[model samples]
Target: MGMEIPDPISIESVGTWSDEVDVVVIGAGMAGVSAALEARASGASVLVLDSGGRLTCTSAMAGGHFYLGGGTEVQQATGWDDSPEAMADYLGLMSPECDPAKISAYAEDGVEHFRWLESLGFEFNRSFYPEKAVVQPGVEGLSFTGNEKCLDVAEVVKPTPRGHKVPVPGDTGGAGLVVGLALDKLDALGVEVRWETGATAMVVDGDQVVGVTWKNYDHTGAIRARSVIVAAGGFVLNRAMLEEHAPDLLAVESNGMALGNTHDDGLGIRMGQSVGGVADYLDKVFVTGPFYPPGEALRGIVVNKLGKRFVNEDSYHSRTSAFVFEQPDREGYLILDSATMVQPSYRFQPLVDGWDTIEEMEQGLGIPAGALAETMAAYDEAAARGEDPEFHKAPEYLVPLDQGPWGAYDLTPGKCFYAGFSCGGLRVTVDGQLLRADGSVVRGVYAAGACASNIAVDGKGYASGIQLGEASYFGRRAGRRATAEVAQR
Candidate 1:
C-alpha cells in the first residue's frame, strides 16, 4: 500500500518560514496558473509550486477545447446566439449532482471568461465544425462537443454549439497553447514559479489554513501565506486512490492511457482533506471509448454480451462509454456492416472481426446464435423507416447496415483503449472557497481545477472541454477571491 494520507501540521510547530507570499498556489496546470495570475493581478504577491516541470501537465496533452457558451465572439461569428441560461440548463442536466451555484456562475460568466482567456493570448477561429466528433480534426473554432445536440438535450434547451477550440491546427495543442500563454503572462508579471517542488502538507493555525509545508529532494520547508489556492490536478494516476474512490476505473489499463499526468496522485486532495476540507463525488469518473472521428461508426449499434443494444450510439463518447461499462462483465461491441464499418480515425476502438453474415458474427462474438440476428433485423427495419424509437438515434445516422461483411468494434474496457480520470475531489463554494462537511467555508484556503469538485461531476453527463474550461475559470475565481480576502485583512 502507499503511504497513509497525512494530517495537516499545526503552524505552532514550524517556527521558521523559508519564504513568504501573499498567495501560494499548488500545481502549475491551467487551474494553478490561472489562480496565480489572477492573484498577482489583484496586487497580491503570488508564488506557484508545481511537482513537475513546465508543459508536463495533462492539460498540455488535451485537444485544446474550452466548453464556452453565452454569446462568445466565436459563437456570434458562427451565427449561433447562445445565452448563459441556455448553457446552464444544458450543463445542469449534464452534471445534476454539481452545485447549482457553480453551474450558474460558469454559465453567466462564460463569455467574459472567453474574453479573459483571449486577453492572455489565447485565440479561436471564427469558423465552426458541424459534426458529431470527438474533437475538430483541425482548428475550426467551435463545435458540438457535448450532448447539446442530442434529441433529449435539445428538448430541454435550444441546441447551440458551445465547444470553442483554439485557433491551432490539429486536434491537440489548444491546451498546450493556453498553458504556455498563461505561463508567459505569469513570467511577465514577475510571479515566481517553483518547479519540482511539492506541497507536502497544509499548515494550519487554529481553524484557518495559514500556509503549506513543502519538500524538494532532501530539502524540507514551508511557505507562509495569507491564503493558499489548491489547484492541484485530479488523482487518476494514483492506484490506491482509484481503488478506494473509483474502483471501476481500475479495470482500465490507465497508467499510460489516462488523460491525467503523474502528479495527479491524490496528494493535493489528501492535503485538502487533511485540513478538514470536505471532498465528495469521489466515485465520479470520466472514461471514454472514443469510437468516432470517422463519424460514420456512430451509425453502427452498440450491443452487450447478450447481443442487445444498450445505449444511443449518437450520444457523446463518454456518455456511451458509461453505459458500456454497465453491461455484464463490462462487455460491449459496436456492430456495423461493410457500408458503415471503416478504419477509426481516432483509432482507439479496435475492430474485432468480420463475418459474411450476422449469424457468423454472432458465433464469433460468442452470444446466443439468434440474439444478434433479431436485434439486427429490428434495427434494420427501423432504419429503413428512418426511425429509431428504441434509442432515438438521429435520422441522419439512421442508415441500415444491410451490406455484407458485418463486423464489431470491441468496446470492453480492457479490450479497447478506455481512458479515464477521477472527477471527485475537495468540495468548494462557487467562489472557490473550500467547504467543510457541514457546508461551512474553510478560511484561508481555496481550491479550483480538479482538486476541487466544481462542475463536471458525472461521466454520463460530461462534455469534452468542461475539465479545462472549469479549471481555468474557477481558478480565476479562487485566485481573485483569495486575494480579495488579503485586502480585507
Candidate 2:
C-alpha cells in the first residue's frame, strides 16, 4: 500500500477554535525554531507545535554542519576566498533541475546567515579540517563536505570548503545547535511551544489555508492562525511512503538505518498536500556508503561487477555511493592494497573479503577470472605516471596500489553500511510559499526544512550541510513573509 493524503477539515467543520495565533509553526526543529523566532521578532504572535515530546528531529540529530559559503568569517580566517557567484555556480552544477533562484539567494545571504547563527551562540572555531573526511574530526569549524574539490567540479568552479560545523567535537554539535542555542532563545522570547502535540490536518476556507487542527493524548482541537508554516520533516521513517516514493531505499532497509527518528512520518507533507500543495522529486534520497576514513583508502579503486572503475574514489562519499547504487544489482567492490588498508575510522564499511593477489580477489568476489587483473594493471599504470585520464582523480591521491595482500570491501547496497533519508517533499518557492503544479500558490501556507523541496532535491547532488543550512535560512524567510502578510492586514 502507498501513502494516503489526509482530507483537510473545513473551517465550518470546526465550530469553535481552541486557540489562536498570528502564526503557527509546526515541528520544532532547526527550521521551525527559526520560523517562530523570526515571526515573534516581527511582532506577530507565534505558536510552535512538535509531534514529539522532545527535540530529536533530523536537524537535531545531524552532525551540525551548516553549509555556509560566500566568505563567512571562518572561511575568510581560514584563507579561502569564496564569492556568491562561485558558490551559486557550484550548487547549480550539483543538480541540473535545482532552482537557480534558491541557489542564488542562499549563496548571496550565506555570510549574513553565518553571523546570525553566531549571534545565537552557534560558535565556530577559525580553522580548517586538513584531510579528506565525511566529518571533520575534533573541533575545527570548516571542512570539505561536498564534491567541490573533485576534478569535475573544480574545473567548473574554484573549489572551496564551506561545511561550517559547530566547535563541539563529534556529532553532538547538532544537539548543541538545537537544545543549547535555539531552544533557550525561544524560551527567552516567550514563544508558545507545545510538545507532544501533532498537527493532524489543515483547516481551509475557500482556497486559503486558515489554520490547522491538532491532537494529543487527551484532546483534539484547532488553532486558527492568519499564517501557518509546516517544518515537520521528510518521510524516510514511513515505510509505506518510502515504498511509494523512493523504493530503492527498501533494498538496504534491513542492513542500514534511516537517518531520521520515528517522527519523520510525512504527515506534515500530507497535511500540506491536502490543501492543494504539490510535491516533486519525491524519488530522490541521500544515500551514503562511506568507504574512506582511513583517508589512505582514496588510493583504492572501486569497480562495478564488470570489474571496471566507475567513479573517482576521491569524490564525496555520497557521490561515490550514489554511483555504486546504480551499478548492476547495486553491487560494487573496492580494491585496496596492504599499504593503503588500515582500521577504518568509521563503522560504515568494513573489509568484507581479502586475498593475496588480484586474481584471487576477482575469483573470491565472483567476478570474471581476468577482469580484476586487467583493471588493476591499467589503474596502477596510470597511478605510476601520476595521471588518471579516465576519471581525473587528483594527482596527490594517485598512489600505485601494487603492495601485497590486496583486499576488497563489499560495496553491494545491503553489504555496505548504507544510511540515508528521503530528500523530496512539498514544492515551495524561495520564500517558502507552497505552489501547485500550474504555478498557483496555496495561500497562507509556507514550509521549510526537509518537508519543503527547496535546495536539497537530488540525492546525487547532495552536500552535507545543505539540509540544515537551507532549513534555517528558508524557515526565517517563511516566518518573515507570513508575518508581513499579517502586517498588511
Task: Compare the candidates by lDDT and give the number of the best one.
Answer: 1
Per-residue alpha-carbon lDDT of candidate 2 for residues 1-489, written as tens digits (9 for 90 to 100): 138887888899899998999999999999999998899999999999998866667777788888999999999999999999999998999977888999999999999999988888767899999788877768888998888888877888888999988877775555445544777898899887899899988999999999999999889999999999999998988889988889877767868878887889998888889988988888998888787776887888999988889998888888888899899888898888998876556666667778898888888888888988898888899899999888989887898889989888787887777888888989999989999989999999999999999888866788888988999999999999999988887
lDDT of 1: 0.88
Error of 2 at 233 (Å): 0.4
lDDT of each: 0.88, 0.87
Specify the poorest-scoring 10-residue window by lDDT in model 2: 171-180
275-334 in candidate 1: lDDT tens per residue? Answer: 788788989889887888778888899999899998888899899989998899999998
| TM-score list, all predictions | 0.97, 0.98
TM-score of 1: 0.97
